[model samples]
Target: MGFGHANAGYRRLFESDGLTFGAGFPLTGANRSSPDVDAEIRLAKHAESVGFDALWARDVPTYWPRFGDAGQTFDTWPWLTHVAANTDDVALGTSSVVLPLRHPIHVAKSAATVDRLSEGRLVLGVASGDRDPEYSAFGVDPDSRDEAFRHRFEAIRACWREEYPERESEWGSLEGDLDVVPKPTTETLPLLPTGNARQSREWIADNGDGWLFYHLPESTLESYIADWRELAGAKPFVIAVRVAFADDPTAEPEHLHLGYRAGVEWFREYFARLEGYGLDHVIVGLEDDDAERALSTFADDIVGEF
Candidate 1:
């Protein structure tokens, strides 16, 4: 009974006026396939010219080659359907999508045909995958990823609300009007539920619309996201970090393998303890030498102080 923001092109990138910026899947032109799709459409038009509010993508399959993170190694649905039909206002996610190795009705009809061809602009993240050799080559059983992420998140929310609901247990069953077509131009489809992939935190606060943490220690990640926002009653919580900036704001942390090799005033006090842990959104992850000069020095010192 919640999810609003009826797609005025995804409410100009997640409503409520401000503070949203994003990143996580940035690698084009150089990913060498000789395809270059305009380097992922100029990395989604350079994250809408640095005002970025969203652009994540990652559903990597095999390449554990000693756990050397091969994210954005391409092929995530024609690279997110060509970055949601060549971005215009940003906001297009998927820092997940491992729902028991495919078939949540083809991940809800290819993310509702890329959210009705980006008019609504997708944001269905879901997860429960970890590449144990690509789920043993799709025999899909790296210990039943928490019962296949609760039967693929209840069959991708009954294939986006029943015109054919009745997806029985163990993930299978869809009779009648079988209507799982492009039903997400609005009426809801912003899924987000990355970690806690094993469910229960009151079932990811009764089916997420937010909550994807990683990289801790901001006072234990603010009492674990304030008990997941008091059990996430009003939804909206995302946190991800793996930054590496150093042009000397007094350079001093150093640890990098995933995150930390700081400076820029300790990465702006680690994004002000990630906005004192309420963190509506923060998904940085630029790596190794000049990821566009550590994302243009984190967009000129931490995206203009939030």
Candidate 2:
């Protein structure tokens, strides 16, 4: 099988039609209270039961005072473990784990552990990280984040591949003395790098197994996917969109933090455009304050509509 279709867990997500739904916000912020662990687990299971394609978790290590969005209100690793145990057969993943915040060994171990526990249902998303305050809080130079990310990426691959790989990195060194445990079920975890992250477009295409881009206009996405395909050599690509649904299909759409205001009709039309644009999969996030209403409407109106 080729890279796009090789992994069963990865392929399942793309093959689905219509709005592939996922929820955002496991975290707490000044504006929003965090969902408790049990609440999130139950919600994840509900999404699975409702036939959502995957479960996505976000990481916001340090909520910069200025950065209003505090995603997934908990430690990413432990939360992922909990979600993995609660849901069966749903692909569990991170929207993008800020790679420069933590050690590569930790990342590899956590990713492997989750993938193992989930029976190979984990997809790891990585980003160079955009929060300067979080970097500063961790005592890392934000200006050097790109370099740190590169070294960490290399280290993560090594941790997965060579047992006790000998290497020296600014992040740290693993002198052939020990290896990370709970090796990933696959030879290498499917890594979807989000945004440019200091890497050139050509490099992102060549290195990443897939691309995770923000919601984009249809024409723009067409051009971007064309560019990616030309350089990516047929790797799958994913897009994330924030959505809001109303029981009344004609209800005036509300503005979303990361997405535009649109009703189900508009969403269906947008998704059709995406399918025509050669997109492999789309992760839909409901940004509405009422989680129950958002999930219910999405499941009843969007999921089945598609």
Candidate 3:
């Protein structure tokens, strides 16, 4: 089924003509060390209170010091469960879970558990492993990632949708002898492939319920969305952006990693343009040290405007 028609988490965060906003986890600016869990949960609750549509968690299983970001410093499952219990109504998502590095059975089980606990509010963003060290560390063949990713994705879907579904792949075979219990609240959970996941655009459009991508310039985004629509139709498109909100509304934009430093006015215009470009959601990673103030300002000034 098309993502728009599916009674899944994607429906909670997307619509055809406008944009919804989500707040990224680790909700603080502490990058070198572990994030303060208390502060993050507090801000997560505050984000929901202030009308953010969702909360996103990243799956960074093994922290490689060379990569430089700790990524919420918690495993995706428990972290999402904690956030799920603490908040009401806001959608919960993994910025992405690395599919190739972990077994699909474990991912399926953990994801369904969270989906059931969250009452069908889980939008799973999945990806092929990107951190090079993780492949060897996990004893997975890096060269086989593309095939592994495809097989795992299929396994996850079968686990969610069919009882003891028989399937065969390089990963393994399910012989219809046993079932993965606690299927999603719906027949299928929403899966948004992150940044191609080593697949072609057509493959992503055909398979993923939605698409989660990195930041791109406005012209590039416009063209990309146009191409996406031709193949995937109304399937949602989501992007993650880093932002540092300046105090003045009129402050001009400056470049930052994967996003920008801008004022409320610029952001308001920028997001509206994104909405016009057929974007569905934007997950904002606040770059400021004072996450509370930044979130409050963005919600009140930018999100409120949208």
Clashing pairs in 3: none
lDDT of 2 at 31: 28
The TM-score of predicted model 3 comes to 0.96
Error of 1 at 202 (Å): 36
In model 3, which range of ten residues has the least summed lDDT?
A: 1-10
Candidate 1 stretches with Cα past 4 Å from truth are 1-21, 24-88, 97-120, 123-126, 129-142, 146-169, 183-241, 244-253, 264-297, 301-306
Model 3: lDDT to the true structure: 0.88
RMSD of each: 17.9, 2.6, 1.5
Worst 10 residues of 1 by lDDT: 27-36
| TM-scores for every predicted model | 0.33, 0.90, 0.96
Q: For residue 193, give model 1's deviation from the true position in Å.
A: 14
Model 1: per-residue Cα lDDT over 1-306, one tens digit each:
136734543354445523465777754424222235565577567756777677787887655766665677775766777887777667778888888878788888888787778777677678888767787787777787788888877787777776777676655777765778877776667777787787787887887767776677668778878898788754666766777666678787787644687778987877776776666677777664445555666777777777
lDDT of each prediction vs. the true structure? Answer: 0.70, 0.75, 0.88
**How do the candidates rank by lDDT, highest first?**
3, 2, 1
Local lDDT at 69 for model 1: 58
Candidate 2, residues 161-271, lDDT tens digits: the string is 778788788988889998888788877788888988788888788778888888876688899999988998567778887776655666665666667567777676667
